[model samples]
Target chain A: MTYTGHLQLEASERYGKSVLSDAYYNGVFKISRPTYTDENLPLVQLIHVGGGYVDGDTYLTEIHVKNMAKLAVTTQASTKVYKTPHKQVMQRALYKLEANTELHMKQDPLIAYKDARFTQETEVHMDQSASFFFTDSVTPGWSKEGTLFPFTCITSKLKVYQNGRLVIFDHLRLKPDEDLMQLLQLEGNTHVGSLFFIHSEVTVEWIQKLRDYLASFCDDQYGVSLLQIPGVCLRILAKRTSLIEKIFAAVEEFIHSTIYNRSAISWRK
Target chain B: MAMTNALFPILQLSDSQFPSGAFSHSFGLETYISNGTINSSASFRKVLEIFLANQFVYTDGLACRLAYEGLEIGNLEQLWQLDQSLYALGMARETREGNRRIGDRFVKIVSTLYPNQVFDQYNMELKNKNVFGHSALVFAIVSKHLGIERETAISSYGFATASSLVQNAVRGVPLGQTEGQKILVDIQPLLTDIVNRIMLLDETEFGIGAPGLEIAQMQHEAIDVRLFMS
Candidate 1:
């Protein structure tokens, strides 16, 4: 038997300020009090009410933003998945960004403990004019004997559609069977971070500058990919979670200040 | 279609003179070569193994297997979706375009050389822009039409891929011809191993590979001077 928790949130701009006009969550899920740090953008924190994820735990999340609206979403804490000898923790998120809308999703790292398995998929449909920013990380959790990759496997997938045409699709699976430390794989890194940003304002020049900026961090291995559509994805493989997050945070700040032409918003961790 | 005459076409198709346009792309080799991670033939062979094991086995190899089965069952929709998934899963734009170009070129060349209904249908889909054809899928269909054995088709396909990279390394990494052949010979068993692994993979296990290669391929796009497209 499996129970599926669901969260639906919608936001729109009213009187020049974004507000959470509609929100619903049931079955072991809740949202923290709306935090307004940008004075107009509402930060919605997803709170898993029934504690950490376990075997057979599944969740569905839907986020929508009306035309001209701006919204930010993050998790209250790290997603911890314990031993799942039988079933894997499955999570799905759907996003709909109307024309001229903006959505930023910066969530905490997912920790896959010993003998755990986790899979997450995100699908997004947005108009050509909409702007979307999302970042995620995967980190190994605790183990009795202190193994680096004790989890069974961790899988993530993202598919993006602009104007009903699939433009970006990224699929990643990390398992112990393959040597993740190889030059063609993780390059001796344990933590993985990814950033996906889609905006009409993206350009070749911007991507070049961003790559130059990231190249300064010689200790961490990073790659920035320009989407066929108007966006970019940056993936960083680092030895520490802080290293990964630092790269992501720097890129995020660059996007905000350089691309969005505003000061970066503090996640307020 | 296996009228004891299939060997000639398979050998010709796998030959380096086929003009498959694989020479124009090094996948992610440009990045590694420029960054000094793949200067020697030895290092190139090591990365090639990783490529065979991590990326190639899961993506193109699996797609070829699936396309073969799909054709046997007369399932065209699955092939269409397979093409789309291949395109979508290609996070790096250059690698995506490179493979797509090679796939489309295969469709064009094979249609004239050995006409088949599956090729016609795939050509139609390509014309409609409904699917982004892949070389692996196209070759599988062609192999089926030619009555080539599954293992032969897979092995020859893998060989062509490996051969092209080695050939590219001859110019990019500047390795000797004998050195290139050594790398090719070295990877033969690994290719067989990859095929064995691909046979056991489930549909859900597709697209499982290292992000490091993808990142390297992505970085190739930003390099100031690039010999290959990918």
Candidate 2:
């Protein structure tokens, strides 16, 4: 069966507290109640009610935040692209943030099973005052045929913009059935992770600390750089999925503690 | 005669003394030198070969090809998009800035030498901050203006990049002048292969996946003392 999902979130400041003024979702997508951390940031989890995607599944997510709203969005669990012998699975996401607003999207890595074809595209539109934090990851899933990286293909494109001017564009395409290591330089690694934090508030001190932190504990191939615009972007390739997750979590915690002066809440599944 | 005529312009643009400001930038090779990852001429040659095969062609070469197509069609929007893509793909701040500076200067020179409406439009967009001027894109525009063949244009840019990297290595690595020349000679076949292969690549094949090289560049930013810009 084909599935198409839509989500729209409009957040605004009211009574000295930022709240979700409008939330909408259709089809197979659902969201939980907002949880606040010490920083008073509202956090929500996007749940795929259908559990996983099959052949020919299409999902779309649209998010927006107005002035003074601080929000974090994450997935309930990893997105699973099951074996598809016929058609491909596609997902599209769009985010818009206005002045004095911030949105952090911590997406769980996509797990592609054998014969699966998954495609994803995400675009961020932001005002100069708005900051965006986003993460995207992909890992090979278990295959019944006992082959590593058995998935047919996975393609993902991410773009960032400030006031309609594109700041960054990244595209990743992996065809495991082919010689993936030689072409894209996966280097015999199975997991790929990327983090992007775009904000005018990113300072030199922050960059230094972040650089030091990444250098301190990395054992796999990883890169952390200040984007041409404001903010930082980190890209990692690892052999294990858990390692990527730990690295991202550590970086997020460091950012929260240093910038927000608050401890990041340790969320439980 | 036609081939030799095309060769002259290619040689002029790709010359090491072209004042493109590329010599001041190591394109991430400085970090490798400082970290001892590329100490010897042999290691340097290996890294350059891998860089050309894995990263440079996919990113810069593809951008140049796309830019040529955009100019050929006279599509300002396409040119703008190509510039944006190339700029954004460069996550390192110095790398992106270097590209912007070199590209802008290249266009300025081309405009003065041979004024054209497309170059003017690109300049206007750059002035308006609508697009980040990338070196590869500007080179494509200049090549088109000079009537350079598409294959020759792309190959010349590749040769220039490889040459600049070698020049930087000679200074940064403190390699002997003869050693640097030998390294360049060693990579000629690889450069030819890469140039040929890059021409066959589709737009989607352009990507970023060389973490070791990228990480070296990222770490270059935080190093207390640095010789090259990136």
Q: Kindly report which residue stretches of model 1 are placed more than 4 angstroms away from their true locations once superposed.
A: A1-4, A13-16, A216-219, B1-4
Q: Calculate each model's fnat, 2 decimals.
A: 0.70, 0.55
Clash-forming residue pairs, model 1? none
Return model 1's CA RMSD, one decimal: 2.2
Q: What lDDT, from 0 to 1, does candidate 1 have?
A: 0.86
Locate the minimum summed-lDDT window of 10 residues in model 1 chain B: B1-10
TM-score, candidate 1, is: 0.94
Model 1 achieves a DockQ score of 0.68
Residues A1-269 of candidate 2: C-alpha lDDT, one tens digit per residue: 33477787877788778787888888889898888756677788898889899998888888888888878888999999998788899888989899989898889999998789998989889998888888999999987778778888898988888888887888777777545563225656778898988878686667878867866876666777788777888888888888898888988888878776777655545
lDDT of 1 at A187: 88
